[model samples]
Target: MKTFTKKLTFYMGKGHIVRDITADIQAVVNESKIKEGQVTVQAGRSVCIISTIEYEPGCLSDLEKALEKIAPRNDYYEHSKRWNDENGHAHIRSTIVGPSQTFVIMNGKLCLEPWQQIIFGDYCPNEHPEWEVFVCVIGE
Candidate 1:
């Protein structure tokens, strides 16, 4: 079995941001030279998440709205009370969305539905928008 790992970083604006990372995961799979295997993509922080979602603008917008409804920012949370911060909703959103996703690699390519794209979503409302995603490909 062969394994390859890559760390990716990017900046996201305030509010909710979803960025597609399908190509990046494929790149790691290609580098690993694994014909059939599995790849895991994980977010490095609690305020961020990795999942599959439609990359279209409308779908992305709706996802953001749905998340807002699930964890409204204006609501009070014990997490914020403890830290004196305003991103309690970010934590809730990330927990619901999850922090990692695993995908199958077949024929040296990611096996995904045409419309299902891997996404790195940052729910933090902070000024420093840097986020990290780790990709690990394993198998032969």
Candidate 2:
């Protein structure tokens, strides 16, 4: 068995935003040279999420809207009261969306549907200079 690990960093703008990271995960898999394996992509921060989705404007907008409805930014949260910060909604969204995703690698390629793409979601209310993603590939 072989294992390959890589860390990806991104500077994200303020507000909730989603960015396609399928290519990055594939790049790591290619670099690992493992034909059959599993790749796990994890967000380094609790306020972020990693998942697969259709990388399109409509889907992106809908995702944001859904999250907003689930965890409204203007709603009062006990986290904000304890931390004295305005990112309570961010934490809630991240927790609901999760922080990592695992995908199968077959014949040195990611096993995903045509419309499925890995995405990184930053739900922080403020600009984040460095958001980190850790990719780990294991198998032969």
Candidate 1 has a TM-score of: 0.94
Candidate 2, residues 35-93: lDDT per residue as tens digits?
99899999999889999889999999899899999999999999999998788998999
Candidate topping TM-score: 2
* Candidate 1 per-residue C-alpha lDDT over 37-60 given as tens digits, one digit per residue, 9 for 90 to 100: 899999998988899987999999
Q: After superposition, how far is residue 56 of candidate 1 from its true place, in Å?
A: 0.5
TM-score of every candidate: 0.94, 0.97
What is the Cα-based TM-score of model 2? 0.97
Q: RMSD in Å for candidate 1, one decimal?
A: 1.2
lDDT leader: 2
Clash pairs for candidate 1: none
lDDT of 2: 0.92
